[model samples]
Target: MKKSKRAITPEDLTKIEVLSEPQFTKDGTSYTFVSTKINENNEYEANIHLQQLHEEKSTPWTYGKYNNSNLSFSPDGRQVVFQSNRSGTPQLWIMHTNGGEARQLTTFKHGASNPHWSPDGKYIIFTASLHEDDDVASQKELSKEEKQQLTEAKSQEPLVVSTLKYKSDAEGFHDDKKTQLVSYSLEGNTFTQLTKGDYHHLFQDISPNGKQILFTANLSDNADYELTNDLYLLDLHSNEIKKLNERSGYHQRAVFSPSGEKIACLGHEYDYAGATLTELYIFDLQSGERLCISNEWDLQLGDYIIGDMRLGASENGPVWSKDGEKIFFIATDRGSTGLYQVDLESNLEILHKNDSHVFGFSYHKETDKFIIGISSPTNPGDFYLFERGSELRQLTTTNKEFLQEVFIATPEELEVTTEDDWKIQGWLLKPYGFEEGKKYPFVLEIHGGPHMSYGQSFFHEMQLLAAKGYVVLYTNPRGSHGYGQEFVNACRSDYGGKDYEDLMAAVDYALDNYSFIDEDRLGVTGGSYGGFMTNWIVGHTNRFKAAVTQRSISNWLSFYGVSDIGYFFTKWELGHNLMEDPKKLWDFSPLKYAENIETPLLILHGEKDFRCPIEQGEQLFITLKHLRKEVEFVRFPDANHELSRSGNPKLRIARLEHICRWFEKYL
Candidate 1:
């Protein structure tokens, strides 16, 4: 792994990169971010950069191959608006905070997005999607071959179904446009619409005397069976709006408070459904009252650490503290994600605890100085420089020359305990060029949000399965999220039971406290719910001498009629619902023990995975090739279920070369 540093190539996924939205600059002495990577046409680009706390490199303020990203900065920070898909899809542009040529602001036709400004910058605000009877100043912009003949004349009409939140593995079948809230008017350059129609608002925060605007919707006229999210607010000088949580719950990111008379948010209510635990509140706008300010906090606030080098959006929060009596945020606990604060009498503090993965932040509020962005497990992230009486300083080693040319590995934490006495935290790694008494071949690796969390970030497919020599591990077990809210609702209605006994007690405590782990060369893998726990661990134990799985499921009664959130994520993680529970969702599915799989699996999926949908990998590759076994499948095509996170970068390097050639052909 390191005679001269090498291992870590799936084409280094276009040379690693990522950084993210950070911001700061209303005289906080400059800052901006974005970065992202993978492009020599393996797509995904992202740009913006900036920096200047007396800089040491960080300049590219928006360059080519599109993806500029939601920027902002205006109130006397002299201009910069962002959100680009360069002339094609995402719109709003505006430039010049000390540089130039960016122009174009809003040429509608269902484009534009999250711009924001107004603190008297003569208003900007943004967000687009219209069609429930259009009209953001009559939605114009067309020609790109008339927007491909109006999307081939609206895909030849005839499609009308109602909605159970009409399909979304990030936009696939929902099309009544929704997502409103506009405004533009940089001194009447015109474009008004501020909130309208059939639900979907989202934007959040604009107040500090910009006369109100924070958002979140669910305008419940049965907002498609009320999957809650309320919080509203609106006013920008009397367009009056109001409604701020009488609580149903699933409140959202909110903000507004450096004396805008209170706001701060992040919500929850679904007690343990979707594995609940999100909390943090505080409301008040002239006496609406509220206050559950992390009611005795139990962690789980933001960044649910699942990596694949991020793509733009950060600044999770409650945010205030410019003497608004403290607020700040970013939570998840025992397996990383730090920076926290609490104050309006609740008193909490931490402000950057370690074991990394901070994910994004900016805050300066007159010298409390933060910047943030962290990530670790040997760095796939940077941007540091905190300050509270000094020292947390690192500004950007943006992967220091791709870490002096590769070889990462690290991990090692582990823990273990579980046959219900509980413990389970995890890490492991070891293989890359290791020597200490040979053995090796271990794998494991699970993470796919059984409520997301396999922490200490930076996981290039667990460093390409510990540089292909294996022994990787991973863990967080019981429905994950940094373990709280009763162990993340202890594996919901027990699918594959108690996160399969905390992943076979961390693989029997990594095969009895690791003696270089061979334990019969055990390899396993995972993807969505770690591909349904590698198809329920090769259909209930064959002690994995190689399995793969990827966008899996292997049945849950046709994943309650073809998953796009499988009809309420199988009654919020299998408590039962396809008419109360068809044989307990086919006795906890993995294709009901695919005729007791004898392990040599492989599967992998994502042919536009609408949340585990390549017919759940063609029904486990045609029932393990009709019981002949030793399966094989693959697929990928226009990828989804975030094909190994943020899909399509050469199919995420052909999904890590098909999970490292199916664990180097059976470990």
Candidate 2:
């Protein structure tokens, strides 16, 4: 039997298309979203538009030299407010719903984001961290005693602390840094601080009556607010605050039902024995009764545990129908994040099923329609409008034009069964100009989180690799989310064991099935956990010709003492402290296997990254260099762990280009 081949051409990689962020109005007949149209001047301009149903197009809202999305429509659908970086940092901007004179509402140096219009449409509230204390110099004033207290709290084992959902990345063991809840009145530019405190407030939801504010914070009685956070309510009238959940476990994503009598949210209040899987729960405000919403209690959901608010995972954060009869949300128990509707009267039922996952959504009360944002492993981010018995309409496609203009090869979804009979999901983006019988270089791209999933989304770096003529294969291994809880926790206390086998199996599957992939030209790359795996792969085998490790963990022992989440992450994932099991941590360190690495390697890191920290990368690079092996290191200054996402846009492009350049040079 002969083998079949897959190939593509350079001409297929440059067909760019244009689209916008889809925002539907209350009437359901019209929708609006942000779009960047390529002008004759060869630059992009941000525009807003309203398109009527069944119409090809209707209206365009034009501003100058900038692009914006994350639109929030008023309750009456008369005004829209969104965040824009047009003035440099992101600030809140407002424009009439029908499109008129656009006005800037916020003018802060540090910028403002996540603007949410009050239910009554009288004011707008959002998260702002622009105070002078966020500055580096101001933060350097912590006295020795304060520093000792912070360090001691962080090092304390089984430490007693208040709050439910605790421990944010980089914040360490103190809750001194806070995100202010600022509200801007529509009539006047006056901004008021609703709830003043020295704790973080995120994912705020106003009560149906607009008389109270519900949000998640870590401001319990404890001075060591570095622990978990819980949901709280602030009465706009009496100015009294009340705690909602009584459990010691993590509780977040709280929202009031349309009737205002009950609150629905998602939480993991019980201990999974240090596992990262969180399920959905609903709490009744009046009676203090709580119920688990999702039947898939063990199913892992969302991307990262940091701010894993259920708002994006669920159809709408405990959103109620206009009549308050049902709730809609996205569930991952079925293997993919599909939108599901739960009836308060009946059992939860699947409403809309798609291969892609749902992220964010907004409801239009007047028309009973909902706007949803969806993403898949193959597709980037796209918006869709879903109404009962109506065909789903794609509202905005921000990258379709760019993707088309680049005309890179689309990934082919692939699934492989592991040694344990675990069916793993993956995709392969074949190289451009590929020919069936001819072999080409292959790059095995790994994802971070160890708990994250690589779904269908337009990734610039991966696409650029395909454009540069290399087959890129990325997969969700054993510990990745989207799979149920057991699968997510599969890597717990066994980091480099089964997970490594899963990745190796994926590489083997690609090599065996793809006739055009050259085994001698194999390469590997990843960030965070992916970076750790990349390090692991090079140490364990010389099959790969080249490797790139970004923000990876080289030594678990050092990582525990250094990383912001080092204390909790190591203990939770490895089930051991350095003192309790130093050998276990060292045995898993990629630097421990430096002698086995025969491949050329590149080390990439962000100087300001506090998560994995740059030292981890330094350890690996130094080890490889001291051994007189092929190694190079690149660091981006003023960059953090999120250098790839939400980092400086220009630098992100540079990072992508540099990685491809490295692969082109060595692979």
By TM-score, the best candidate is: 2
On the 0 to 100 scale, the lDDT of residue 243 in model 1 is: 88
Best-matching candidate per lDDT: 1
Mind giving the per-residue lDDT tens digits that candidate 2 earns over 250-366? Answer: 766677888888887767754644455676667787788877766644555443321101111223455677787777665564335666677764366766667665665666666
Measured with C-alpha atoms, the lDDT of residue 643 in candidate 1 is 70
lDDT at position 282, candidate 1 = 87
lDDT of 1 by residue, 1-667 (tens): 4447878878887888888888888888768888988878788889988888777788898888988888888888888888887887788889888887889878888788888888878888888888877777767777689989877987999668777777777777887888888888877688888888888898888887887798998887887876788888988778888888885888887887887888888888887878888888888888889888777777788889887777677887768878898888888888898988888888888877778889878888888788888889888888877888778877788878988988788888978887658888999988778888888889887888788888898888788788878888888888888778888888888878878878988899889888888888898888888889889878888878888888888888887778877877888888887898699888888887899999888887878888878988898889889999998898978787877668888888887898899788888
Angstrom error at residue 546, model 1: 12
Instruction: lDDT for model 2, please.
Output: 0.71
lDDT of 1 at 111: 89
Tell me how many clashing residue pairs each candidate has: 3, 29
